[model samples]
Target: MSHTFSLSRVARLVGVPRSTLQRMVKEGRLTAQNGEVEMEELLRVFPDVKWEDDGEYARVEEIKKKAFAKRIFERALPDKEVLADRLFDLTHEYATAKGLLAHYEQLFEWVMHKLDDVAEAGGAPAAQAVADCKLWLRQQLAAAPREAERARGLLAEERAMRIVSVQVKVLPSGHEFFVEGSDTILEAALRAGIPLNYGCSNGNCGECRARLVAGEVKKVHPHDYVLKEADKAQGAFLMCSYTAVSDIVIEAAVAGAQDIPHQVIATRVKAVELLDERLAALHLTTPRSQRLRFLAGQRVRLKADGVEGEYYLASCPCEDRHLELHVRRDNRPFARRVFDGLRKEDPVTVEGPEGSLVINLDSRRPVIFVAWDDGFAPIKSLVQHAMSLELAEHMHLYWVAADLGHYQDNLCRSWADALDNFTYVPLWVDGGAPEVAARILDDHPDLSHTDLYAAGPAQFLQHLRDGAMARGLSPRGWHAEVLA
Candidate 1:
């Protein structure tokens, strides 16, 4: 006869959520009849389920019942040597002595009876035989701890010889992934093809912030993002900065549909032109089957001719199967190649469509965009995407650069001239200016109902954020992404 259990009971026994069991059933990993499941299938699905002593005893009883039949006299049992060996094996398998003793009490009694039977009827007394058995039992008990310790040492050695992996479960979404010893949770999730919200990967933006529901993790790196103390106290951590030490559950904000399903594709450069001496626009086309799907304002990792770097998508997603990237000719080798050496029809590997800078279409609040230098790349994409949405909310853009000539004022002015809901302002500030924040605050004194997005130098963005907070801007409403 086989033991059986219900789906809910199996879920409880395996320590997984009932919904997960349901999903397994839907996926055809499990089968049920009237909500009942066979014990064999349950064990097969989760082979690592640590059975308690009572559970082990029940299993043993089932095994014995299947192996034997009742008789008029008592059935012959295993010899003392066999019974003692089984008891030793049980002790080695179980972590606690209480459970082992409860499960093997009958076997122990049989061993004691065998010792008493060793004495002849007249030669040795039953009391002496009992005393000898007790003495032998005491000796075995005295060595039990040492034997357990030796067994643990062997187990530890075995573990050290193999790579260890820990399970991480993301809440709300119920996405699960395994993090190996050397990988961060964010890295593991991405490797497992799970899309998680993250930015700067170095832990500066707090975009990958998650709350730890349970389990231990060690911080792998330090983050400069100023997380609220209240959030810190409640177990918020940067997924990119921590590695799991044990199985863990984290409550991470799930990314929107538009923000996920990232991929790496080989794209052909359709055209390349110098926007100016410092900036070049590269047009790329993906293969018909591998057209990239990405939100406007996201960034991609571009690799060509042994050079790789991250560049923002300057074009709108409305432009199908094509991507436009604005590359700045900086001291970096990748930038130099893109600006001076790369040509049309060159094969470039593009990875990502990442960044948490996409617009929140649900908000009806007026929008303000502040861009500095090539920070305009993402801002350009954002504006284009917003325009395609046909949003009626008034939108204004402040374009600032080191020199007035670099602001791409003409391009923005064209949008202002073409769109009814758009306004563009260009400014040049060569050095640090206290008046920049003051001008913004003066223009938007009542920012309580506005959504302001500032992108540029880290220090400059921080300054603007501080000012925004001081002038009635809700911390949650203000969005800032630092450009390094």
Candidate 2:
């Protein structure tokens, strides 16, 4: 029988993004049956792929390691029980295949004996014909197919992948991520930049309960929140406490910006990075059990040394306990404190992740992000979020540097260099709002199919909105926040 793999598994085995595979299917360049791709079809579609080389997969893993520092790979391997279960499943499959091979061998022997009997009864002509047929069958069986080596490599790689990490698909929202190492479903989801609804991440509040639609799960952490017997029978489990043992489908909730609740987390000053003489990046780390939950592009109120100020988060939510804020050397209380003397390990209170200018997770259109001066803080967060999601068809970033002087210019350039779909343009704030807006808008004459996110002064945003609308951008496609 031919092997068939799910889209997620196929993407991993081929070292490509799931979105790329989906697009190929949509464009008729590839074929899939019921969301699974046959092994023959996969080989036909990607003939040049060197299945033995895992460069692409390794690159993605390194990127994830940098992005999700502590939450990723707490252990080098999965839990022992989960590993055993996976091994058991693989062994069962091997045994079944071995049994089938034995059965086929017995059938071949029986066929040979019947041919001999027919030859003995029918005489010399019939015996010669039977001998020729048996010789052809033996030759065909002995000759290896052209794809045999590549197919063997692919199967070996996929089996290794299955043992190391399991793919997960969330229902309703259709978001997919992989559970690697010893990560629970909730942890993996958050690391992927997906906001799954939960209260206490330790599984006391029961908010992380989800139903298993398919596959197996192993409980790695004990939860105080108890499920009813009926619920257990229905495959209900806490996402924060269970790790997947195989590729799984789950019915769970994906949160939007509004779905996240306000949180007051007592965080410590991890470091103070001086980007320029006029700007500083304050790094804060929350307690292990009480990580602040917020979407990208949101502003938080930070209080330190009896003073507080509101600033936009410059870090992606996927960064686990680490939170980053860009503080300009202004008269604001927190900015003054950060510039003056915010040492490492100092106490800081973070509260109210208040802002609606978040990424639209559902949109797959090309994105244009415009940031003015220090407004790049939120824009940077949004850009990282978009990168983690990998949902945008293309991304264009235009930074109109004013006082901050493109402090993170290298970072932007690195993003552009790393991603084929990303582009970065740094501009000087020479003329006023209209002139700058016109200059940026001049690049794209047609904005109807694009999503534009701009963070700047109110006047600049107004000019940008008016110009973009005039250039066929729908009102729904335009999103802006006044940073001034």
Worst 10 residues of 1 by lDDT: 66-75
Deviation from truth (RMSD, Å), model 2: 2.3
- The TM-score of predicted model 1 comes to 0.47
Tell me the spans in candidate 2 whose CA falls farther than 4 Å from its real position.
33-35, 60-75, 114-129
Q: Write the per-residue lDDT of candidate 1 for residues 261-366, one digit (tens) a residue.
A: 6788999998887888778878888886455656767899999888899998887664546688888878887788887778879999999878877776556566
Clashing pairs for model 1 are: none
Q: Highest lDDT: which candidate?
A: 2
Off by over 4 Å in 1: 1-259, 430-433
